[model samples]
Target chain A: EIVAAIETALGGGPLAGRRVLVTSGPTHEPIDPVRYIANRSSGAQGTAIAGALAGLGADVVFVTGPAEVPPPAGVQVVAVETAAQMAEAVRAALPVDAGVFAAAVADWRVASASDRKLKKTRDGIPALEFAENPDILKTVARMTEGRPGLVVGFAAETDDVVAHATAKRARKGCDWIVANDVSPATGIMGGSENAVVLITADGVEDWPRMSKAEVAQRLAARIASALGG
Target chain B: EIVAAIETALGGGPLAGRRVLVTSGPTHEPIDPVRYIANRSSGAQGTAIAGALAGLGADVVFVTGPAEVPPPAGVQVVAVETAAQMAEAVRAALPVDAGVFAAAVADWRVASASDRKLKKTRDGIPALEFAENPDILKTVARMTEGRPGLVVGFAAETDDVVAHATAKRARKGCDWIVANDVSPATGIMGGSENAVVLITADGVEDWPRMSKAEVAQRLAARIASALGG
Candidate 1:
């Protein structure tokens, strides 16, 4: 496939013989058809990642939520919207070499969905009940059968970004957690560029801000190098 | 002001006595009226940080490049485009309690710009020259007068993510470097969720993945918590 040629051109085909699965964007939690809870995620990071992985020669399966950008060519793409839908899609696409749960899936979903959009009542307000959604990262990380060799999760923090992220990695049972402060001023979410910290059991590593695409390229290379172990 | 109230409601009123400066988004390096060399960066992370800092009650000055989204409600907003323009904005805005260089400034720019878009040559090949751009984070971090109490730079990495990021923090002369693997698969760019690593002289600390908004909130809170030191 021409895709194979492109991958070889990028480098040594770092991800050669590896299978990678990635999640991207915000998973919607619907209160009603017209009203849903969603974060401001454009999915640029996710799609860029898919391209990055393919460029490294990985057989990548991208499970994406709704995104403004097109998915990268030459990868298996499964699209979904809600948190539950995303979880299912990821589950079906697994048995990969590695997994990165980068999606901002809502922590909670409406306890019940209204088939129709809820009308604005004459009363001042309306209360919608909710329940916790499945933690996809945790699920995959803890898989008993054919678990990916590496599982990474994202922990976005506004305060004590490192502290909370460290705890999260332990709680979620993932091998790594990438943390960042996404305060509105940082312009990370729903934005094109990002600044983040990578938290692993070993320690933390800081970075200078750069284009997300460049970041993807480098990460793919690193993952490929790690595959030799 | 209502903006101040929103800050309090957002759980960042601790910044009341502090002063903070933040830079967000990508700086456009213009080559012509219709075209420019610019990285893909939305102002989400930086803007979120500005909001978080403001919420903590800090007197915040937000220096931003071209961003699609509106700046958080209650902070001083300065909009610039080119990396040079961004540097100017930061110079005017600094001398704060803390400074966060969260913007994804282009590393290089066209050596010269054409007043109009250049037409394609008959041969269909054009040569464009480039030069290194200013290092804003290093400049501010190494300032002689009224230097910020805390200065942070972001490290966006893909390969040797942690090792490279740690080196960047030292090169930039910042107190801390927040590193993220932007490998296309990591999805830190243009995504709602992020994973980060924090690197200091002592060691690295990895954080968990969460919503970008939460990351901003936690980072701001930590900054405030470290106010006395």
Candidate 2:
């Protein structure tokens, strides 16, 4: 019956009944007009997730940074560049059913972004001051009101991946953490397939590597299950 | 002096005194002409990691699945297709200081592959017998001879990501597992960027999402630190 209900919903589900919020891509901390600190994140994952959620009978608000790929179809898309912007967008989209923080948010941003490009005068060395960005996952998890029923964070690591991810779930105060090694050799960052581990308070679940599309489909199914969709 | 000496060895340092073995990409199980069961991994992350390891001065042996991307410069590259082939290659390149299993290995293979393509059926799903493939991480981790000092596995999940990863690491007897949520919308499988959690018996470490390349650099540094390279 539950499955039947979900099928019915997907066939013509009411988005007015459910809302989801997601974040994706790499946040940039500008040092100058020509140079900025950023990682390689296309935001494809986040946008794809938003699309999947919408398909599964939810109203999705996708908050994203600049990405190489386009967002998925059929949803309310909110575009943002910096971590702060992404955070603001997320905060506004709350009181939703769920939240997935898939964005590659920079931990540190320039203390003060330069108004113009910094000139290099062949100095011995130059140092740029940095300040930590707001922890979006922690923020939402700790929200007093308008909080989503579910909050998930992604941990990109290199060593002791599982142990660290489990600890992160606690530290971030989120319900779940998805862990993966980003070692360049894994091609996990900008490539076409991934091997991932899901972490939660209960323990861990390791899935065999699969296509990103497969991951999205399964996750949508699981999220729907959680929402009683 | 340490850095200079290491750089001299490979025109680099850290990895100079280390031997690193890495496995990446997806295994293809051919079912028939132009038809094979395979994951959608491009081997970009894995190869980049090998490059990062090399950059850190480790002598890397990159055992890879068929990838469109070329191996990073300077590392010893061994290319293979099937999981069995990859296993053989890894075993042959053993006696390394550390090992990372980043490949999205196919869990099963066609029991008997057809030499030619089969005709389409009128009204039925095609059935194919399957056999479990050997787990490279488990095999290497349990090896009594020529085993690398550190062994890691990749766990991809959609639901219960961490719980399943923890169990897999324990079962595989690996030193660590990189857990990731490859849920579809996240685009974690391809197009660059990832959010991952590092898991181990000690606990979880949640890292902000980043490029697979950046993750590789950090991981290499960690390995070097651990080995005192």
lDDT of 1 by residue, A86-135 (tens): 98998888788888887777666768966443433445224556577888
Q: Candidate 2: lDDT of A47?
A: 67
DockQ scores of all models, one per candidate: 0.01, 0.01
- Model 1 stretches astray by more than 4 angstroms: A1-229, B1-12
TM-score of 2: 0.49
**How many clashes does each candidate structure show, in the order listed?**
90, 83
B101-136: candidate 1 lDDT, tens digit per residue: 888787666678665434334454245565667889
Docking category of candidate 1:
incorrect
lDDT on C-alpha atoms for all candidate structures: 0.76, 0.75
Q: Which ten residues in a row have the lowest lDDT in candidate 2 chain A?
A: A117-126
Which model scores highest in lDDT? 1
Q: State in Å the error of residue B109, model 1.
A: 0.9
Q: Across residues A1-229, which tens digit of lDDT does each residue of candidate 2 receive? A: 3654576466655333688888888776665432444545766666667777777767788888867678888778898877888889987887788898999876667678665434223452234565778889999998887778989898877567898788789988998887877665678767767778988777899978887766776677777777776
